[model samples]
Target chain A: EAGVVQSPRYKIIEKKQPVAFWCNPISGHNTLYWYLQNLGQGPELLIRYENEEAVDDSQLPKDRFSAERLKGVDSTLKIQPAELGDSAVYLCASSLQGQETQYFGPGTRLLVL
Target chain B: GIQVEQSPPDLILQEGANSTLRCNFSDSVNNLQWFHQNPWGQLINLFYIPSGTKQNGRLSATTVATERYSLLYISSSQTTDSGVYFCAVDEYGNKLVFGAGTILRVKS
Candidate 1:
């Protein structure tokens, strides 16, 4: 079976520039999540969505980071005016509705100069 | 909020040897998963043992949710096993709280 898929596996932008990452989850999966991982660290949850509704986004930085799963099958995570600290891997994962083992995609590595 | 702690922040083992990695959580969890982040930066799901024991090839995992701990055992390790291993838990939703991973390097 095809796992979660993410685009632009690597991105580099100047500080204060906006960047976006896209993800397409495995077929039939209903839960999607975005996570941020610094070097040598485990991923930290940024937001989680159940279908079209964002159920948990407390960890997301609203001022700069915004995410949407408009169609419920695919998701997009955006960072506006990204800072140097935002230079990290943006990971996308998916699972069955409610709760299930998540399958992750090859993350997009963002580098802000 | 939940706290997850992994033991032996770093481990080094020779090929064909055995090793154990542990995870301890601060509170009750509804689900638990083990992941291996390979050199290419892909998070590979190793096991989803919220409780009980499971084995796959040279690897096995046991989760004692009541005791708030889980263990991953690698038997006859190989150099390809090098990477970081992470433990994540969720109490309310699939959103996980992750622990700092344990870095393992298996040498030939």
Candidate 2:
């Protein structure tokens, strides 16, 4: 089976510009997650979706960051007026509902100048 | 929130050598996973061992849930094994808390 897929593997934008990343989960997977990874650090959860409902988004920056999984199979994470500090890798992962194992996609590398 | 710690922040080994990486958690967890992040930043699942041991080719992992620790072993390491190894734990089942990760560089 194909693994999770993400679009625009790399993105570059100027500070204060709007940017968006997309993710497509594996077939039959009901849980999807978005994470941010800084250089020399492990990934931190930004948002999590179970089907079409966002079960966890406490770590997400509500002021400038927003995410949605409209049809439940695909998700989009957006950053409005991106800041210089927003430069990092945005990763998407998926797994079966109630299952512990998660598979990750090749992440979108964002560079804000 | 739970704490996860990985030892030997970095390691360098010649090809054909063996090494082990360790991860210690602060509390009991329902799930534990090991991942290898390649140079291109793709996270490849290595193991989903919450307890007991599992092996796949030259790699193996063991998780002792009761002890709150896990170990990943790389046998006869290859240059392809060069990457960052991360250990993540889930206390509530969905949210994963990850360690800083161990950077491995295998020389050919």
Candidate 3:
């Protein structure tokens, strides 16, 4: 089976511009997560979705970051007025449930200047 | 939030050598997983071992939940193993916290 898929493997934008990343989890997976990974660091959870419901998103920057999972399937993460500090790898992962092993995508590498 | 720490931060090994990576968590966790992030930036799930031990090919992992730590062992290491290894834990089974990762370089 194909693994989780993410769009625009790389993205480059100027500071103050808007950027968006998309993710499609593995088939039959019910849980999806969005994580931000900085250079020399591991991924940090930004938002988690159980089907179409966002169960945990406290780590997400509400002012500039927003995410949505449509119809319990594909998801999109957006950063409005992107800042240089927002430059990082945005990874998407999926699991059968909360406790299952998560499979990750190739990730979208964002470079904000 | 639980804090995960991985050590020794960086390692360099010769091909066919053996090495062990350690991960420590600050609190109790219901799930723990080891992932290998390749040079191209793909995160590959290595093991979903929350406790006990498991082996696959030339790799193995042991997690002692009571001790709040896990160990990943790679034997007969190949150059393909070069990359960053990360350990992630979920205390409530809903959110995952990841360690900074151990950067490994295998020389042929």
RMSD of 3: 0.9
Candidate 3 residue spans exceeding 4 A from truth:
none
Please compute DockQ, using alpha carbons, for every candidate against the native two-chain complex.
0.87, 0.92, 0.90
Return the top candidate by lDDT: 2
> lDDT score, residue A28, model 3?
92
- lDDT by residue (tens digit), candidate 2, A1-113: 88999989999999999999999999999999999999999999999999999999999999999999998999999999899999999999999997888999999999999
Cand. 1 TM to true fold: 0.97
- Residue A33 lDDT in model 2? 98
Cα lDDT, model 2, residue A73: 92
Sort candidate 2 into its docking category: high
- Weakest ten-residue segment in model 1 chain B by summed lDDT: B89-98
Please report the candidate that would top DockQ against the real structure: 2
Scored against the native two-chain complex, candidate 3 gets a DockQ of 0.90
Pairs of residues clashing in candidate 3: none
Looking at model 1, residue A57 earns an lDDT score of 95
What is the lDDT, from 0 to 100, of the residue B90 in candidate 2?
93
Clashes per candidate, residues 3 or more apart or on different chains: 0, 0, 0
What is the fnat value (0 to 1) for candidate 1?
A: 0.83
Question: What digit string (tens of lDDT, one per residue) describes model 1 on residues A1-113?
Answer: 99999999999999999999999999999899899999978999999888999989999999999999998889999999899999899999998875578999999999999
